[model samples]
Target chain A: MAGTDPIHQFVISDIVELFTIGGDGTEGSGLTFSFTNSGLFMVVSVVLTTTFLLFASRNRKLVPDRWQLAGEMSYTFIANMLRSSAGSEGMRFFPFVFSMFAFVLVGNMLGMFPYFFTYTSHIIVTFGLAMTVILVVTIYGFARHGLKFFKLFAPSGVPAYVLPIVIPIEIVSFLSRPISLSVRLFGNVLAGHITLKVFTGFVVSLGALGALGWLGALLPMIMAVAITALEVLVSAVQAYVFAVLTSMYLNDAVHPSH
Target chain B: MVTQAFAQEAETPTEQNLDAAIDATRGEPVEGAVGHDPTADTHATTEAHGGEHDSGVFPPFDPATFPSQLLWLAITFGALYLLMSKLALPRIGGILENRKHIIDADLAAADASRQKTDAAIAAYETALAEAKSKAQGIADQNRETIQADLAAKRSAVEADLGAKLSAAEARIASTKAEAMTHVDEIATETAQTVVTQLVGDVSTDSVRAAVAKAKE
Candidate 1:
């Protein structure tokens, strides 16, 4: 067992291990299918977001209450982001963008709690989301523009001699979009959580030492507080960045002019 | 300090057994043994111990846990997408749309009422101006009529006074003439009495002729 390790906070624990359907697995006999803390937190975020939306707009008054105003603001915030990035045509994918934004935002925020898991910090989850966005954009591009979608890789003013170099580079860059997108989010979140944990570990180690050590621990404690505040801002910003990039990619699929 | 702790965990019998189990599961020789853990499922055992937990560097990178994580992510993402697209989002959209419509209707109604109030004020001003002009016209007309009537009355009064003055003058002239004749007769009578008393009475014809000559 790993004891008192700050990195242990990220470990996904199996809450319920299953063999066949809901059947209990014997000890180390068969491979265990399990529900994890990561999954639990994801579901929690979904529920929270859904309930917030429902309760906020239940009254739907012309003069909005606080809850209703909050709901409206988030809606308009995403709507405007999509509209500005992808134009009026981008409003069709409003729900998708909003969902991604809320999911990431809530997940990051909830993970800031003392013992909660941050699924967005995981490469698999973030990559899955990124791939989904890319897949949707590719499919939509092909569906809307047919063969003309391939023109997105080729610039309009490029010389025929430069086409060989430019097209490959563009294709490579285009393919790297998902990787960058996923990594940026995951790296930011993971780094923030790790830094927070490290600082906290410092506080614990110092406090455990002695009277002088407790006094020294105050510095890292202060740093942890500041970092927590920064992480909150980062969480919101990362969610916004994800949503905006998704919109931009969707815009490329829709227009694909340059 | 952290390195020493990890090294201690590595040296433990339970840690060795756990590492062997992980190695057996992955079918790899446990040759490189510093700061490396093959399986994420080792956390399940560590968590079961209740007093300690596994501290992998990057647990999410573990291949054994990818299936379940991806599966759960897919299910959750699918559920979220459907909820947002079909239900939650549309409801919010409806609320926003309805609010916009209501606000627009209210603003339009306010504008129309304001316009009506402006028109009413304009009409009131026009009526007041017309009434003031009409009153002034009536007063001017009445002044002109009164001035003309006064002029006619004054002229008629002057004419009647002139006629009466002339008549009085003529009567005075006739009275003076009669008085002169009487005075002449009286003078002749007085002279005749004086002459008679003195020597002899003068003749009436002679007195009358003398009086007439003197008057002339």
Candidate 2:
């Protein structure tokens, strides 16, 4: 902890790396057709989410226990947001929306643990997620609304005289959803972690004065704690916003006239 | 026989006191009462709970097999989506549809009732107006009949009075004429008698006096 290089120390290699197999002589990496770190993390997130929901939903008492209540509240929060934005008609999508929320929330929280990578901070992962949602929305829009869904690109009540100008702008704006949604999540996580890394680097570089700089160390410590809390909030909000927007997109699929 | 059986069932005095003492101290479990019991049951249950390898607790991560991550995500997402579509969604849909139907029916019934109440109120008002008009018409008819009856009775009385007055006048005239005739006849008879009795009687004067009195 004292003599290490914090900047280089936190650098996670992009290549698939091997992890030990317990009581076996096998090696595994992300693409090795075996268990991988990212795969394990994904599995962990799923298992955690599943167990929590199972335990929480077991009795589903009107007066909920603590963990059950927390789970229920999370579910209701996302569901209500979707419903409010997309209407009761959007309740049909609750399962997908709920799963998305749970997945993103658990993934963000799991990455917050020491020795884990912020998977969402990585572009490949974020891009993949973003593309998946975008693809679903696109296909659904077409399947549900047909050619009328293309009207989503051309908003109604826009003055016919302004069509040439407005349509292009609208198209661009509509296309930006996936990009903006993905970048918003990716940027927030990447920025917070990077900021943490830099401050921690300063704390290490200050040498024995690092302890003397303990008072100065309070700054990074406060930022870390504050940023951690903010990150959790951002995690929940991003998931909610994403789900809500997805529902809105679906609403457009259902009613392209709007 | 009952007394003997009761005595036989009752504990001896020393044993009864001991039983009371044991019940009293049972709150403090005897040290070895449960101490010798094996923990096999607990161990069995713990093993049963962990029958699956899914503890959900954080474990080591390996990066070599990334595809499995995608596979797990795909599988879970697929299963959940399918189950939602197949099972949970249909039930939720039915509940929502039923709720919607009930609400719509209630609203419709309320609307129908409101319309019915409005119609009833209108009819009542109309009936009240008609009754008022009928009552007014009946009163008018009664008034007209009473006025006509009074007029008819007054006219008949006036005509009868007029006729009677005329008849009485005529009778007075006739009576005056007859009186005059009688007077004339009486005068002639008196003159004849006076002339017969004594030529000294003034038959003209007496006749003139009688005529003047009759005129008066």
Candidate 3:
């Protein structure tokens, strides 16, 4: 009964009060500068990512040790993903893509631990990341190709009659990219965590019935364990999906064609 | 934001229903009802605290935390990007490049050494063939010089022997002629003496003639 609140885990509570502007930070009415659990985790993710990479690459051996290999493998993995989705020219965005990937991936993995806040589960956080990607793509596209960046919607080889229908649809879909991108990650993390919490809650609730209930709790316990594993996999996959999609969107900025 | 508000509105009813269901189950009259009451009371109080904390809004959809979260995200992500670009990526790239260079250098050195060995073997074979031919040439020259000297010495010995044989034959012929003349004179003298003794005071001329006729 105690752990039965599935929605309670997502609560963002302040650890330190910094300042507030325009209002007293109540009823979503003010710009609060308080450091919350979400901010703490963000800092944790950054520190952890930087420390691991820096420590892993400390000894640059010709025949790399396990740690160095891990560092090198992650480097190549993001590099290859970007280069394949975009071209070698896309490598200019390597730092950005790598940072995005590391941030999301680390955040997701950290959330798998009990009592850890899942920042990626928040729509606003995911949406901000998605919007940043879209902003970069748009700005770079316009800078590089000028008005021709609009050509992404009006693809070539469309029949003249279908162009009227296809262009608007394409435009709408294009406009929906950040929404879809942000929602996909947010929804997956939110739902998976909720389901895991719910199942785990069932175990606690049923086990309150004593000996008979303990036997019944086994099924939910197993389900919770299985869903936790699945959520771990989903966390990694969603991060990869975010990075890959970012690269592909950047590709449109670089090429801006069908 | 509106959709999220609607979603929160929609989710609250279900959560309340689930909470009610849990409470109903805990409220069920069991053998250990007396013991379960205290635990149920604690659950109710904790639920109240959770409700106050959440404030009827889903935490993920709560706009109050957005500014702080976004600010932190920007700060942390910017720091991560700078660290990666400035430090980690270049180091890894350099290590890989260095390894490739070393391996290529090693391969080139090995190739050069193999070529030197091949050249040395070829030179050794050529020198051996040259020495063998030179030895054969020296042996042939010695054999020809010795054979020429032997032929010259045999010819000189044969000419000297032929001259000595002719000279000896001539000397024997001359000595036999002289002996024949002497023998004729001696026979004449002996015939004359015999005639004088037989006839008293016969003439020398007649004796000589008779001796000549007998000899004839």
Candidates, DockQ: 0.28, 0.09, 0.33
State how far residue A250 of model 2 sits from its true place (Å). 2.1
TM-score of 2: 0.53
Number of clashes recorded per candidate: 1, 12, 0
Preferred candidate (DockQ higher): 1 or 2 = 1
Q: After superposition, how far is residue A100 of candidate 1 from its true place, in Å?
A: 0.3
Candidate 2 segments whose C-alpha is farther than 4 A from its true place: A1-34, B1-216
Rank by TM-score, highest first: 1, 3, 2
lDDT of 1 by residue, B1-216 (tens): 344434654666376665655654555555445245545335434545442223334686865456667878888888888888887888888999998898899999999999999999999999999999999999999999999999999999999999999999999999999997789889877776777789876777886777678767
lDDT (CA) per prediction: 0.82, 0.61, 0.83
TM-score per candidate for chain A alone: 0.93, 0.82, 0.96
By lDDT: ranked, best first:
3, 1, 2
Model 2 over residues B1-216: C-alpha lDDT tens digits? Answer: 222322332334354533433443443443332212123222222234332111122111222223444554566556555554465434434444555687899999999999999999999999999999999999999999999999999999999999999999999999999998887778667666767577655566665676567657
Docking quality tier of model 2: incorrect
Residue A231 of candidate 3: its Cα lDDT?
Answer: 99
* Over 4 Å off, model 3: A24-28, A156-162, B1-53, B108-216
Q: Give a tens-digit lDDT track for model 1, residues A1-258.
A: 243466677777776643333324433333345678888888898889988998997986778899988999999999999999899998898998999999899999998998889999889899999999999999999999999999999989989999999999989989999999999999999999999988988888899999999999999999999999999999999999999999999998888875
